[model samples]
Target: MPHLTIEYSPNLGDFPEADMALALNASVCASPEVKDESDLKTRFVRTRHFQIGTADTPRAFVHAQLRLLAGRSPKAKQDLSERIAAVLRRMAPRPDGTLVQLSVEIVDMDRPSYVKESLG
Candidate 1:
């Protein structure tokens, strides 16, 4: 099970937020290994501002975190991370030259209390 959470600056309007969520969810569900759509959950959070290094950039910065169940092999994790980053870059291209930080974390469901809830 993997839970994908996308947190971005509120500069992105409702339409962009909804579009990004759908794109990310589709990317994850498109994974060959993911059998059930219900197993994939995506949440989007829009913040007022996000500090990047010392300077606060006006451009919106998108950070994505994908938390997966523990049993997945290291190779799978790396592949998933690459796929997620690729999808984000394709979806959230920067108007400016600033970079979008995409982070991926794979958590073990056994050691942690990660639950697989419906994506309703």
Candidate 2:
């Protein structure tokens, strides 16, 4: 199972979080790193109070943390992250002079410690 958590600054007004999630899921589904698309879990968390650089300068950021069970190759991980970043760049528009930053972080979870039981 791969759980994707998307965090972003609150300044991203009218952000296409849902659409971005769908696009991301589709991208991941096409990757060889994942077994199935249905196993993906995604959510977005908006940062209400935060600052980057000068207080007056307009800045916004979207960070995606993807957690997966250990055992994937380093190349696969990098590919996934890069694919995600590309998607973010295409989906998340950068406002003029907003200094928007998009990043993706891949986290490897201990396979033995990770537990899950899907209910149908």
Give candidate 1's whole-model lDDT.
0.69
* 20-84: candidate 1 lDDT, tens digit per residue: 77777787788775778777778877776567677755555677778766777888777777777
Off by over 4 Å in 2: none
Instruction: Kindly list the per-residue Cα lDDT of model 2 for residues 2-112, writing each as its tens digit.
Output: 999989988877789889999989988788888888888889899879888778888999999999998999999999898789888998867788989888999999998
Q: What TM-score would each prediction reach against the true structure? A: 0.73, 0.93
Give the best candidate by lDDT.
Answer: 2
Candidate 2 TM-score, true structure as reference = 0.93
Candidate 1, residue 119: lDDT? 64
What's the CA RMSD for each of the models? 3.3, 1.3
For model 2, give the 10-residue run with minimal summed lDDT: 87-96
